[model samples]
Target: MVDNRYTILVSNEQFRFTRDQLESDPGNYFATYFFGEFAEASQGAKELVVEKDVHLFRLIQAHLRGYDIFPLPDAAIPPYMTKEVAIKNLHRDAQFYCLGKLEEKIKELELMSPNGRTGVRRDSPSAKRYKFGDETWSGLEWMFQDLNNDGYQLMLGKLKNLDMAIPSEQPLIPGFSLTFCWAKEHRYYVLLASDD
Candidate 1:
């Protein structure tokens, strides 16, 4: 059976389209994804906007704690948490829990974890070219710009394919990782690639 636990984490705002709408027009199945920060919105903390699979609502709630405008899936805590808190936590969890390794994908397109952080495989050469965030982006970029520009949300699959393969034994810097997401299969899937 589908895990009902996933349903509890999502807010009503996420349900942009009805089940019938998805059946008639799959492309219209889009929703506003709110990536919250750990502090006040005016501070460095800000929500990363993106279009993602509806299933991610549960995964997001799984990591959340305390009160929030959006209640946590398993949390009994009240809605005291701000968007900032949610954003910070999500960033932390996404870096760890989201994607598979780069070397694995090169071997086969199937999703698989690598030996190192995210998708960086151990013992791989340091010659691979990589980018910290969006390789196609530059300047003071907003975290959620892609979400607004593109009608669809970013999915984990895109991250898996973005070649975020970094060298092994290196710590993933805060605010940066060789990860990406893709919007497909009605969900998001992150992948490990390096920008080294």
Candidate 2:
């Protein structure tokens, strides 16, 4: 009997996907790569060698097998104790794989400040937690622009202890303190006074 299972060799390790399973997501690159008009198909190859991070590839495999959202790193993974790097990497991978749903889900995750909770955003409105990094500043730039147009709310509420005083650190965007700050984690100062 002919085995309908196909092999995906990642770093010399093996993973399997059935023809039926792959055909289901014909739009995905894996399916196209394995089954499209190519040398592998003509040669009747049953396995395709893949070159990618094994952990990430496993996540992609799980996604193809119907995993909606991959979990962020739970513990301190070097250079990424924060959830930022993990999600960003996954989002990059999702885009490469053309997985729209996974990419969108990653984007919908909360933009947590250093002093904020990193729950799924449905858990709590996190304004204070710990470890404000470049990620948080990047997030704040556009997320609370309406409320922190003058950097008042951002200073008083979110970054109170960080010492991000207005004007000195605030952008000269007139009415908007528009800037992507690189200062977080280390001590800094910031506060805002409203025009009202």
Model 1, 1-196: lDDT tens digits are: 7321211123333333223322221121111111123333235321233443333444333223211323224353224545435434444434443322212222221112122123433455642322222222222332221111111122343344544333232334434343554333333223334344
Q: Supply the TM-score for candidate 1.
A: 0.17
Candidate 1 — which residues are off by over 4 angstroms? 1-17, 21-122, 126-129, 132-196
Q: Give the clash total for candidate 2.
A: 17
Per-candidate Cα RMSD to the true structure, in Å, reads 18.3, 14.3
lDDT of 2 at 15: 88
For each candidate, the alpha-carbon lDDT, in order, equals 0.30, 0.52
Give TM-scores for every candidate, taking all chains together and pairing residue i with residue i: 0.17, 0.48
lDDT of 2: 0.52
In model 2, state the lDDT of residue 19.
75
